[model samples]
Target: MNIENYYNIDAQGQIVSFTREQASSFAKGIAGDFNPIHDEDHRRFCVPGDLLFSVFLAHYGVSQRMKFEFSGMVVDSTQLIFPAQLSSHMSLSDANEKNYMDIEVSGDNSKEAEFISMLSEKYVQFSSKTFPHILVPLMEQEKVMINPSRPLVIYKSMEITLDKLSGKQIELSLKEASLTNKGKKGEVRLEFAILSAGEEIGHGAKNLLLSGLREYDASQLDDVIATYTQRKSEFLAVA
Candidate 1:
């Protein structure tokens, strides 16, 4: 996926803005995420959080170990302002310093486009499947589910640990998908392994925060899944 098509950067090398179309297209084209909130014409037209994660890695270089904590969502209209460099701990914010994400990095780094592209594509394809392929089973096992009308699943954090940053083409496989909840809040952790040429190279976890949880309702969830699948089908058919 050519992530450069998803956002704009000024001549000064700072990311400037994301158009609704750009964000929506990236969500579908690369991440295979058809969430309506990412629809160009949706009322809540926000850029996919995974897009931010991808842009950060593309620009700053991927480290052997990294963690990203998202604090807020990014609307298409928000012009992002970034730090001059990627330090040990960096917070990405808007012009008014409205922090949206915090990043922490350590270990060796690679700026090679081939490796970065492979990693970005592999990681996002896995992360984007959290909805049904991964989350549904976890929710069923836990006997808890998010609100069907206002499903608010937040990208709390994601971390990756790589044994080394060298790989011709990357592969990511889900090692486990688990959920731990208390009261109305739940955290879903999707642990995955990174491999190259069928050999394990590293691992990572994508953490999601689900709020307004309640006892799982099979009927309600089935309806929700039907809606999601219908939207995805319609979008793809048109595209």
Candidate 2:
């Protein structure tokens, strides 16, 4: 699938416009993210954080070492502009200049279309599986649950460091995932390794902030999982 179709971007002007439909499509189609908040009709609909990250990489390319720090949520129909010029550090903001994310890149960088596409595609697929495959078990172990009424788990930041990168295809493996709780809030860290031809070359971590967390209830958590699974199935059936 063409990445441009998923994200409407003006490369010359370095601006992006996100519609609710596109957001929902990227969540389900590309990231396998079934979070209700990404649903176009949901009350708190917001663009999937992974979608934003993927767009950035596709536009600005990838570096040997990179960091992404998110400050605000990008809502549907919002317009975002890339920095006027590429640099080691840049901030992504809306038309009003409200910063949504900060990005820093260092070391070797490649704007090659093939390299960027491969890296973004591989990393996003791994990142999106953080939900049931990783976070659910982590939350259960921690005995805390995000508010089921309006579950909010915000992508805080992510960093990747690579020894070297050069390949036609890339693979990502989850190395570890951990959660830390403080009062009603929690932080989740997902560590991963990058491999090319079965040789490890890079490492990265995705950090998320969970808010409105409460003591976990088995029944409630089960209901949440059931709902999420059903949503996935429904989408798959229609697709």
Weakest 10 consecutive residues, lDDT, candidate 2? 1-10
Model 2 agreement with the true structure over 156-199: per-residue lDDT tens digits: 99999988757756889999989999978999999999987788
For residues 1-239, could you state the per-residue lDDT of candidate 1 as single tens digits? 79899899988887667899899888888888977899889897788888999999989999989999999889977988877787888888887889999999999888988888889988888888888888888889889999999988888999999997878668899998889988799988888999998889899999988999999998999999999999888878988
Global Cα RMSD, each model: 1.2, 1.5
What is the Cα-based TM-score of model 1?
0.96
TM-score of each: 0.96, 0.94
Score each candidate by Cα lDDT: 0.88, 0.86
In model 2, the number of clashes is: 0
> Which candidate's TM-score is highest?
1
